[model samples]
Target: MKSLVLCTFLLISLAGCAQNNKKEMNQNYSTEEQEVINVTDHLTELMIAKDLKGLNNLLDKDFTLTHITGYLQPKAEWLKEIETESMKYYSFKPVNRKIEINENKAEVIQQNILDARIWGTRNHWHLQQIFQLEKRNDDWVILSSVASIF
Candidate 1:
């Protein structure tokens, strides 16, 4: 009678709410993935521009950087190396860049070639770099990276 009708109505309302919540959850995940990819791409652009300040802002304090030459350096050490050498002497050009985002994590793969003029001598090297990024506090930051000589 009246009780049965009320119970049915309540069940239908609850079911609709659950469906809406599930849709919202999916949208949130998609948005997070897009954010991670966009941030990583921005990082590469910063690198090409040699924007140290931008780089600092995007990188986490505990960031780990690994080179194609098997050298692993902490954040401070990496910044110091660039500072001592002068970033003007070299340029990093990344080509064939690709990004993949999943959940709160992202991976950026790119082929890079360095053009350096030091002591009036030119040095060049090809590189394949993979950047692993994580989302923290709604911002994407690089967690770790590894590169290989190409």
Candidate 2:
């Protein structure tokens, strides 16, 4: 029947459109995910370079960094460490990195081994870090972070 033939054509067309839409969505997600990763990478670079102003611009006002030793370092204290070179990071190797983005908020979970000098001691530590970020005025800013040693 002509009606059946037309219905089949319509269904096929709709399926193709659906597949295209899905592919576009996946591409969009990939782009957004890469943006999040870039932000995180830039933050790390700022820390490594002891760029206080850059870090300040990227960190939210209420930012907090919870250390593996159960001590909470507020933004000022963490920046001070970087400025004084007391907590110097030499290198980091990210083992497992996962990111989740929900609308204007994102969370990045990373498992990494870092070589750093904390206070006066130098060591390589395997750490799990969770970072929370929010889009503020079209720019992603880090809101908080928690790190645990493994």
Candidate 3:
């Protein structure tokens, strides 16, 4: 009974999220919102491609990545993990997303089925990240990311 219940729960959860490689979500986004989306999309690409330098250009100096386990990983350490492949991202399928901007700050919530090997566990994680970004010199740069399950 427990096994059947667990399987049913898992299936229901996966049904709500994207399982394909089609990345784009909504087409009627405002121009400002689209700019913010572009930044985050580039971020995902950089992560999967393991381009640390390019990723650095898009993040703030005091950037942080908060994992689902509530571990607050500093940017330097996270980059090191990516460099060493302790955290390796393969691909992302964004199912749902939203962006809100106030003045020069933007908050983006994105849910994706991400294929990755993290800390030796490889799975297609139903990942959701609340990313904080700030506009500096007319460019949107990620300040932090708080991750959770979809």
Candidate 4:
């Protein structure tokens, strides 16, 4: 009984420590960096929700998506694929983020566990997406995203 009680206490303490560490890591970023991260997180939400209009508004006119296979998909075509459910995103969870800002431009490397169906194959993919963004008229616009397996 004592061993079980001790183990339970240790588990609870470790969980609390993890929560504190996550909060501390988030606090390390500046307000501007958080804004950029928000845009990227919003993109994941939009993707999973299949919000084509929202995605379109958040992205640049000349945006592109580079797949892990080295295929560069143009914005219109990619949106069309999503609209047609060819490239369907079911859910996503962001696990890590890194953002760098220079003037009005930023680069965000976000790691996610993404549940998606692409070209008829469904899998939970560990994805690392590098997104290029630019601030325009007080709003951030995603310029492009290149995806790779992490």
lDDT of 1 by residue, 28-141 (tens): 445566566557657657765667788788888888788765789787777665555543335665455566777778887766676754334466767677888877777888
lDDT by residue (tens digit), candidate 2, 95-142: 667889999999999777888898898989898889999987878999
Model 4 Cα RMSD, 1 decimal: 2.5
How high is the lDDT of residue 106 in model 1? 83
Per lDDT, the best of the predicted structures is: 4
- Candidate 3: misplaced stretches above 4 Å? 1-24
Worst 10 residues of 4 by lDDT: 17-26
Cα lDDT computed for each candidate against the true fold = 0.69, 0.85, 0.92, 0.93
Please say which candidate is ahead in TM-score: 1 or 4.
4
Clashes of each: 0, 0, 0, 0
Tell me the alpha-carbon RMSD of every candidate: 16.7, 13.3, 7.4, 2.5
Better of 2 and 3 by TM-score: 3
Q: Give the TM-score of candidate 4.
A: 0.86
Determine the backbone clash count of candidate 2: 0
**C-alpha-based local distance difference test score of model 4:** 0.93
Residue 99 of model 2, lDDT score: 88
